[model samples]
Target: MPILPRVALLLAACLAPATLAAAPDRAPQDVSGRVLRATGTTTSGEGIPGIAVSNGIDIVRTDAQGRYRLAAGAGQTVFVVKPPGYRFAEAADGLPAFWRTVPADRTAGAMAIDFTLVAEDRPAVSAPEVLLFTDSQVKSARDIDYYRRDIVEPIIGRHPAALGVTLGDLVDDQVQLYAALNAVTVRLGVPWFHVPGNHDVDPGSTGDAASLATWGATYGPDTYAVEEGDAAFVFLDDVVVRPGGTGYVGGLREDQFRFLGNYLAQLPRERLLVLGMHIPVFDTGGRETFRGADRARLFALLKDRPKVLLLSGHSHVQQHYWHAAKDGWQGAAPLHEYNVGAACGAFWSGAPDAQGIPDATMADGTPNGYAVLSLRSGGGYALAYHPARLAAGTQAFTPAMALHAPRVLRRGAYPAWGVFANVFMGDAGTRVEYRVDGGDWLPMRRVERADPRLLVENVADDVATALRGFDRSPEAVPPTHLWRGALPTDLAVGEHRVEVRAFDRWQGEAVAATTYSLQEAGP
Candidate 1:
C-alpha cells in the first residue's frame, strides 16, 4: 500500500497520484480540453459528452458540453482517449494524432487542448483484430527499406487487421528514423498505435522526462489509452531511463500509476483490459528486469478485474508468462502476459534472401514476424503469428512450427536420436504430439534445448570466412517452446512420414510434417 502525499502535491497531481519517488516541487497548471464531433458537412461544433480525457496523471470525462479540465505539471502530456465509433485525423507523418505535449517552458497560465473525432460509418464491432509488431529496431535507411519490403509489403492493401500497434523499439537508438518508419506504416492505411521501447529513447536525454522528447514529438503521448470493440487498450511507457548513462530498466513511474488508478476506476468491469508496454513485468532470471514492487502494485490494481491481458515486447524472443501466488498476483486465475517476438528478430541479422532482406530468425528459432491479436466477442481473445517471409527462401506455406530430423537412421539400432519441433508461439503447457506414417499420435516431450534449425545455421556461420550477410544469425539459445520425440529405427527400411501436431490455446490445432528413412545396420 502507498501512503498519501502532501496536500500541495495532491493538488499538483490533480487526479490523486501516488508516487514511489515524488516529483519535483512545482505547482501545476490547469489544462482544459473539449471533445468535439466533426464531419465532412458540418464544422461549427458538436460536443461529445462522456469522452475520457487525461493530463497524464488524472483522467476526466467530458461534461455535457464535451468539456474537461485537469491539472498537469511541466513536461506532462494532455491526451484524449480515442473511443470506438470514431476516427482521428492523421499527423503530418500520417500517424493517427491524438495527444499534445505540454511545453516544458510554460509555468503559469492554463493550457487548452482540444480533440475532434469524425463519426464512423458503422458502430463498434463485436470483435476487432490488431496487428502486433515489436522491436522493429531499424537503425538506418536500409533497415527501414528491409522493414517495408519484408514486413509491410506482404500485408499491404490486404487489410489483414482492423488496426496495428508496434509494441516498442520502433528503432535502434536512431530517434530520427521514427518518421521514416511511420512513413512506411502510412501505406498500411490503419490507425497505428506505438509503444516506446528502450531503444526509442533519445541518446542525449538527461533524464526520463527528457528521454522521449523525440518520441513524443512524433508519436504523441508516452502513455495513453484507446477503446476499441470490447476491450480498453492502455499503453504505458515502462522503460525508465537511468541517470548518467547507466542504461535503462523496466519500471513504472508514479504518474502512470495515478493515471491508471483514475482510469481503471471509471472503466466498466465487464470489458477486457489490455495492458501494453515495451518491457515484460516478470523478473528475468531472478535479476529484477522490472521493479517487483511496481509489478505487485499493478497486479493489485487488476486483482478484482476478471478479464485482463498483459502484452509486452523487448527480448528478441517470444514467450508467455503467468503470475502466481509467489509473484503476488491475487486474481482469481493466474495472470497471462505475452512477451511477443521481435519484428526485427535478433536485430535483423542473418543471411539475406533473394529480396536482400535478412532471414532475421530469432536466436530461439522463431521467425522475424508479427502477431495477430483477435479480440473476441466476450472477454476471450485469439492470437496467431505471421512470418514476414519464409525461412531460407523456401516457397512452402508458412509453417506452424519448424521440424528438424535426421534424414536416415540405422535399423535395429537404439532409438537414441529424435525429432525437434520449434513451435514458434508455444508455451509451457502447449499440447505437442507426433505420429509416424499417420499412425497413433504420441506425446512429444517439451525440452529446453537450442533449436537445431538455427544450430545448423550457426555451424554454417562459424566456418564461413567472409561476412555471411548484413550480420550473422544470433547464436542459438535453448528456447522454452521446443519439443522432442525419439525416432524409432526398428521400423522396416523405408521412408516414413512424421507429423507433429500442437494445440495452441489461441489459434487451436497446428500440424507440421517431415520424414525419415531407415537402413539395415551392417555387421
Candidate 2:
C-alpha cells in the first residue's frame, strides 16, 4: 500500500506540469485578424504597423508585422475604422462599407481573417446609381435654414441608398459657411460627397493645389471614384479657376488626365461609366469653354465606350443632351449628359415667400429643383425631376363682351365705335377681330386687364348710339348702345354680316359671323 502511495505521488507530480503547460497552450474562444498594408509588391515587405481594429467591445492595434490578434466571442463582428486620409465605400443606403461577420462554426478553430490594404484607385463596379446636386450656395444662416427646410430635409426623407455628390458652389464665397453647410447636410444620415465649385476656390490662394487640398480635407479626395451596384462612378475636379480669379474657366491638369487614363484602363468597357463633376466637357451654354486638351484626351479615352453618362452642374439649369454616334462623337454609344440645376434658385433671389425664401431663378431661367436617378432591378434606370412647389390642379377662364355707341345717331345709320378686347393666359389669348358686312378687317384693341372676372366693361356712350342709329337728342333718343361711339350715316336698310373672329391662344382662331337685317323707320 505504501509503495502504491509513492507511485501515485510520483504520477501526480508528473501530471501537474503537463496540466499547467496545456492550460497556456489552449486557445481562447475569441480570436482576431489583422488588416495590414503592404508596401511595394512583396507580401513579406514591411507591414505598416499601427492600424485600428475592433470587435465592438475590444479595440486593439496591429503590431510591427501589421498583425493583430484579439480575444473575441464567437460569431462576433469585426470591423476596422478607416483611419484619417483613408475612406471606405458606402453601401447603397449610405452605410459604411464593412466586412460581414464570420459564422460561429467557421471560427471554431484557429481562424484567420485578413485584409490587404492598397492605395485606393478610382472605384470600378458594374452598374451604379449616381447622386448629383448642384449649387447649394448657401449664402447665410437664413439661406442654410431654407436649404435645410426646403431641400435637405425633403431629400433625407427619401432615404436614398445611392451616394450623394454635390457639384460645387457649396458656399457662396463664404468659406466660413462650409462648416455649417456640412453640418446641415451630414444630418442626411448618410455619407454625402462634394466637388469643388468656382465659389469654393480661393483665387488669391498660394498654390494651385491648395484649394483641392482644402476641399479634400472637408470632403474626401478632389477627384475619386467608387463602385456601387454594377457601375463605376468617376468624379472629376473640373472647376478650373484662373489664378487670382473667381469665375470658372475650363481646363484639367496633366496629372488628373493621367490618373483618369489609368483608372479607365483598369475598368472594363462593359461596365457602366458615370462621370460627375462641376464643369461640363462640352460647353452647352456657348459661354463656357471646354476643359482644354486634358479634357479632350479624357474624352478620347472614353469616346469608344458603349455606355457613358456625364453629369454636370455649373450652369445652374436643368438640361438633357444626347449625342448620337451619327453626331461624330468617338463613343460607340451616344453620350447622355444631364446638367442639374442649382439648389438655390437664382442664387436665392426674387421675392420672398411666407417662409422668407426667395423665388430665385437660375441664370438659365430654371427654378430650383433636384434630380433623382433610380437604378432599376432589371438592368435599367429611371430619372425623376422633383420641383419645390407642389401644384396639382386645372385652370380655366370665363368670357364676357363690351360694346359702345355715340349719343348723336340718326335712323337708318350705322355707327363706328372703338372696340377693345382682353384675354388672359387661361383665356388662351384668343385672336379677336370685328368687321362690318362690307367693311375691311377692323383690328380690335387687345388690352390686359387685371381682374379676370370683370374683363369687359363699357368704354363710351357714343358707341351705343352709332350701333342703334338713333339721333343725338337728350329726350328723344336715350342712349340704347352699350358703348359710346358714333354710327355711320351712309348705310342703307339691308342685312349685314357682323363678323367676330376669336382665336384662342392654344387653338388658333375662329370666326362668329352673323347677319342682322335692319328696317328703316320714319323720323
Candidate 3:
C-alpha cells in the first residue's frame, strides 16, 4: 500500500463511525501533521529522514520527510516525543514541547500536526504552571515511599501543568531506587524529567561512557530540552563523577558543553532560559566551595544571553543571588541563581517530624526548603521559598531584647560603634532596636526587607568596651538582642560597651552584650 493513499484509507475507516454518531451539522474529526526540525525562521522543521509519533498509545515513526499520519478519535490528544539526541523548544511555562487536540473529520484531510525538530534553537511553549523539586536522595525503598507520600503526592494534588523536574540527587547511589522513585512519581498523571546529581552516579563506575550508559538506560538522556508553554528549559548533567571515587565534583564534559553552545546559539535571544543542574554555579558562603573552572566555562556560554535563570540543588539550602556582571560575564541582565533546598531535608538526618520527615539543614546554617519559581514571559521570574515540614501559618522567627546606649558606654570615648543581636526562627515583620551611649533607644533597620526565617542583628558605635553580665557560650544558640545607639567621640582609652536586643514576631525580646576597649592613637 502506498503511504499517502494508505493513510487516506486509514483515516476514512477511523472516522466512519464518528461521522455516523455525530449530528449531520457536526464535523467529523481527525488530525494529521508532519514532525520536522524547527529551522531558521520557520515554525516547522523539514521532514527529517526518520522519526516517530504516537497518539499516547499507538506509535508510528516518521517517514523520510519527517511526516507521520496517525488516527485519532475526535477530541483525542496527539503528541510527538523527540528521539534521543534531539529536543523541542521548551514551552513558555517550562513543559515538554507537545501539541494536542480533538480530531474533527477523518476525510477532512489529515490535520497538519507538523513537528519542527531543529538541531539548534527550539520553540518553548508557555504552560499554565510548573512544579520544581530538588534532591530526592532516596537511599532505600522506604525513602522512596517517604518522598512519594510527603513530596510527590502534595505536588500532584495541586494538579500542576505537566509534571516536575528533580534537580538531582534522585538516588543515593543505590541505582536501583531509580525504578522505585519513577514508579511513584510517574503516577502523578504527568511526565517527570530529571537532572543528574552527585548521588545519582555510581561511585564504582568510571568515565562518562560507562556511567552515562547506565544513566541513559534509567533516565532518558544526560541532557535534553523541553518546551511547556513559552519558556525554554535546558537540563544539564553537572554531577561529574570518577569511577572508584566516593566524592564527586562539578564539571561539564566537552561534549555537553558543545551541545549547550549549539543549543543556546539557535535559541531566540529574547526567550527565557531555565537551566537546571545538580550543583550551583555560584557559592555564597566560604564553607561550601564551588567548582571554579566549571562555573567559569558555564558562565562564559551564558554571558551573551539576556534572560537566564540558573536552578541548582547541591547546596541543600535555599538561597537566591542576582548577579549582573559578576565573575566576568557580560550578560545584558543580571542572572538569578536559586539554590533549591534538599528534599531529604538535611539528608533526612535532622529531627524527625510527626510524619517522620527528617530535619535537614545545610552546613552553612540555612534552613531546608524547596523553591517555587515562576518563569514569566519576556525573561523574568519570581522565586519563593517553601519550608519543608512547616504549615502555612508557622512562625519561623521570634525577636528578643531592647537596648539602652549611654548607661552601658558612659565612660568610653570614641566616635561610633555597632551592636549585634539574633532572632530565634525569624519570619517576616520582626523588629530590632539600637541606641547611642546613654541615649534613647531607636528602631534599627531590619536586614531583611520582608519576613525571613532568620534575623541578623548588628549595631553601630564608636567607643569600644566589653559589656559585663551575660555569659556567652559557643555551643549555645545566640541570644536575639537589640543594640542601643552610637558611642561618644574622643575619650580616654578604657573599656566600653555595646549590646544587641532582638524581638520576635511571637516572643517578646532578649538582650546580649559584648564589650570592646579603646586605645590612644599610636605615634
State which candidate has the highest TM-score: 1
Q: In terms of TM-score, how similar is model 3 to the real structure?
A: 0.56
Encode model 1's per-residue lDDT on 479-509: one tens digit a residue: 8899999998878899988888989887789
Error of 3 at 17 (Å): 38
Q: lDDT scores for all predictions?
A: 0.82, 0.53, 0.55
- How well is each residue in 1-523 modelled by candidate 2, as lDDT tens digits? 1011122234334433343244334455445455555333334344434444445443455554555555445545555534322334443334344333555566445556675443233343233344557888877898888788877887675754446778778988777787788777777765566778877875365446566545543554456565444455666778666565444576677656765675565455665677888876666544547654655576688897776778887766555666555433566656777677678755766545566566553433334667666554323454544555432231111122222222233435554433322221112223456776657766554433222112111222234545221112111111111111123445656655455555543335544433444556666
Candidate closest to the true structure, highest lDDT:
1
Better of 1 and 2 by lDDT: 1
lDDT of 1 at 17: 29
In order of appearance, the predictions have TM-scores of 0.91, 0.53, 0.56
Worst 10 residues of 1 by lDDT: 1-10
Clash count per candidate: 0, 44, 107
- Compared with the true structure, the alpha-carbon lDDT of candidate 2 equals 0.53
Residue 449 error, candidate 3, Å: 18
Candidate 2 has a TM-score of 0.53
Off by over 4 Å in 3: 1-127, 243-246, 283-291, 324-326, 361-369, 391-523
What is the Cα-based lDDT of residue 26 in candidate 1? 26
TM-score of 1: 0.91
Regions more than 4 Å wrong, model 1:
1-28, 40-44, 105-108, 392-397, 521-523
